[model samples]
Target: MIIEVFRANGALLAAGDDLARPAGLTSARWQVLGVIDGEPRTVAEAARTMGLRRQSVQQTADSLVADGLAAYRDNPRHRRAKLLAATPAGLRALADVERRHAAWADALAARLSPADIAAATAALQHLATALDQEPSA
Candidate 1:
C-alpha cells in the first residue's frame, strides 16, 4: 500500500509538471509559488511547509527571483532570512496552472465521488502523521 501510494504521488507530480509547463514552471517551482501565494515566507518556512530542505528551497527561490517570478523582501521577524513573495509574473503563472489543474481535477472528480476523495485525503494525512512520528531509518 505504501509503495502504491508513493507511485501515485510520483504520477501526480508528473501530471503537475505537465500542467505547469505551459506557464514555464516545474512542479517544484509551482509548489513554492503556491506556498507563498498570499503570505510571504522565509526559505526555511517554505521548506518546512513543502517538506523540502532549506538549501533547496533557497536555490529555487533565487532562481524564481532571477526569472522575475518572485522577489525577496526584508523580513521583520528574521534578520537574515528574507521573505519570499510572488511577483505578478509568478501569480499569473500560478493562475494558469491552477486553471489547468482545476479542470483536470473536475474531470477526475466526476468519475470519483467527493466522499471517496475526502476519505483518501484523510487516509493520506493519517499515513503522513504516522511517518512523521517514526524515527529516521
Candidate 2:
C-alpha cells in the first residue's frame, strides 16, 4: 500500500505539473500558492503544512516573490519569519490552474465513483497521519 501510494503521488505530481504549466507554474509552486490560499503563513509554517523542508519552501517562496506571484509581509509574532502571502497575480494563476484542474478532474471522476475516491482519500490521510508520527531515520 505504501509503495502504491508513493507511485500514485508521483503520477499525481506529474499530472499536476502538466495542469499548472499553462499558468507558468509547477506542481511545487502551485502547492506553495495553495498553502496560503486562505491565510498567510511563514515559510516554515508552509513547509510544515506541505510536509516539506523549510529551506526548499523558502527558495520557492522567494522565487514566487521575484515573479510577482507572492509577497512577504511583516510578522508581529516572529521577528525574522515574515509571512508569505499570495498576491493578486498568484491568486489569478491559482484560479487558472484550478479551473483547468477541475475540468480534468471532472473527466477522471466520471470514471471513478465518488465513494471510491472518498475511501481512497480517507485511507491516504490515515497513512499520512501514521507516517507523521513516525520518527525520522
Candidate 3:
C-alpha cells in the first residue's frame, strides 16, 4: 500500500514538473509556495509542516527567494528569524499548478468508481493521520 501510494504520488509529481517548469519553479519550490500562500512562516515551520528537514526547506526557500518567487518578511516576534511569503508571481504559479493538478486528478478519478475513490482517499487519510502521530526518529 505504501509503495502504491509512493508510485501514484511520484507520477503526479512528475506531471507537475511540466507545469512548474514554465514558471521556473520545481516541485519542492512549489510546495514551499503553497505552504506560505495564506501565511508567512519561518523556514523551520515550513519544514515541519512539509515533513522535511529544516536545511532542505531552507535551501528550497533560498532558491525561491533568489528567483523572486518568494520574499522574506521581518518577523518582529523573532529578531533572528524571518518569515517567508509567496510573491505575486509565486501565487500565480501555485494557482497554475493547482489547476493542472485538479485536471489530472479528475481524469484519474474518471477511471475509478466513485466508491472505490472514496474508500482509497479515506484509507490514505487514515494512514497519514496515523503516521503523523508517530514519534519522530
Candidate 4:
C-alpha cells in the first residue's frame, strides 16, 4: 500500500508539473501557492500543512517571490516569520493551473467508475487520518 502510495505521489507530482507549467510553475510552487491563495500563512505553517520541511517550502517561496508570483508581508503575529501572500499575478497563474487541472481531472474521472473513485477517495482519507494520528518519531 505504501509503495503504491509512493508511486501515486510521484505520478501526481509529475502531472501537477505538467498542469502548472503553462503558468511557469512547478509542482512544488503550485503546492505552496495553493496553501496561501485566499489566506496567507507563514512559511512554517505552510510547511507543516503540506507535511514538508520548512527549508523546502522556504526555497520554493523564495523562488515564487523572485518570479513576482508571491511576496513576503509583515506578520502582525510574528515579527520574524512573515506571511507569504499571493500577488495578482500569482492568483491568475493559480487560476490557470486550477482550470487546467479541473479539465484533466474531469477527463480522467470520466473514464473511471464514479463509485470506485468515491471509494478510493474515502479510503485515502481514512488512511490519511490514521497516519495523522500516529506519533512522530
Q: Which residue pairs show collisions in model 2? A: none
Identify the runs in model 3 with alpha carbons over 4 angstroms from their true place: 133-137
Tens digit of lDDT per residue, candidate 1, span 1-137? 89999899899999999999999999999999999999999989999999999999998999999999999999998889899999999999999999999999889889998899999999999998999999989
Models, CA RMSD each: 1.2, 1.5, 2.0, 1.4
Query: Sort by TM-score, best first: what order?
Result: 1, 4, 2, 3
Predicted candidate 2 versus true structure: per-residue lDDT over 4-94, tens digit per residue: 9889889999999999999999999999999998899999999999988999999999999999999999999999989999999999999
**C-alpha lDDT (0 to 100) for residue 103 of candidate 4:** 98
Top-scoring candidate (TM-score): 1
TM-score for each predicted model, relative to the true structure: 0.93, 0.91, 0.85, 0.92
Candidate 4: stretches off by over 4 Å: 135-137
Please list the residue runs of candidate 1 whose C-alpha ends up more than 4 Å from where it truly belongs after superposition.
none
- lDDT of every predicted structure (CA atoms): 0.95, 0.96, 0.89, 0.96
Return whichever of 3 and 4 wins on TM-score: 4
Worst 10 residues of 1 by lDDT: 105-114
Model 4 weakest lDDT span, ten residues long: 128-137
Better of 1 and 2 by lDDT: 2
Residue 42 lDDT (model 4): 98
lDDT of 4 by residue, 77-101 (tens): 9999999999999999999999999
What's model 2's lDDT at 85? 98
